[model samples]
Target: IHVNISAEIIKCPQFVRALTIAIVIVCSKPNHSYEDFFDHVHVKLLTCYIRSEPLPEPEIQAREVQCLYGIQIMSAALEHPGGMVLRLFHKLYQDSVISKESFELWKKEDEFKAGFDEDLETKTMAVVVLISFFLSLA
Candidate 1:
């Protein structure tokens, strides 16, 4: 019988590189919808990625990579053609997962605001990536 590996992968330690890869792979599958990214399972994962304590050298690196990968997944979801990028953006925005301060900066700062107002793809990625990096640092 086939099994859903994503659920199992979610249970893996946050420092496991495979966890990020598995999550992205599974969520990108045709059978899965963008909604899966906001599910409780992933919400918890995001919280862990943001709030978990730093680990030792190699593991810390792995954790950072995973956190970055998680952000990359969200960015990819937003950039995918024929996808609900706006819906995903709204979900992350409303849920406060995208960093309120950064989102505000995107709205407030002229340089950042212009890129965001123009709906530039790279700007979306940049904001989320930076916020995720900050989260990892915290």
Candidate 2:
């Protein structure tokens, strides 16, 4: 689980994306249970994201990790729906792995407009997850 990137370098945008991609890689592993995935996410997320200083403006870093993670992790998340996926989403925000600004930007942007515009199901699922995560906040 030594993701190779240093704490200082983890502040970089590319490294953040790479970290997220690592999460996706673990998620896509075949035959894994949600519990197993949960363990992996907890470890990697805490190690790579929480321990490092969050990327902030004026710091010059990529900020799309949340949106990218939402889209890429959709399939794996959909498997557990309100259980694992929703909890992961909550942890992402609560732990500040996803910033409030990122969620706001995610809300404003048509994330699926590029190629997933025609995918009503995917769009719907993304919305559901977003709403669910928000509602849990209230």
CA lDDT scores, all candidates in order: 0.46, 0.50
Q: In angstroms, how far off is 108's CA in candidate 1? A: 9.3
Candidate 2 lDDT (Cα, 0 to 1): 0.50
How do all models score by TM-score? 0.41, 0.52
Candidate 1 lDDT by residue in tens digits, 58-86: 44344443444344444554465333344
Name the top TM-score candidate. 2
In order, what is each prediction's RMSD in angstroms? 10.3, 5.3
CA shift at 89, candidate 2, in angstroms? 0.6
Report model 1's TM-score to 2 decimal places. 0.41
The stretch of ten residues in a row with the least summed lDDT in candidate 1 is 109-118
Worst 10-residue stretch by lDDT in candidate 2? 58-67
Residue 5's C-alpha lDDT in candidate 2? 51
Q: Write the per-residue lDDT of candidate 2 for residues 1-138, one digit (tens) a residue.
A: 346656556554545445555565557555655444535455556445433554345332233543344434555444534445555555566555565665555555554432333344554565576786666555
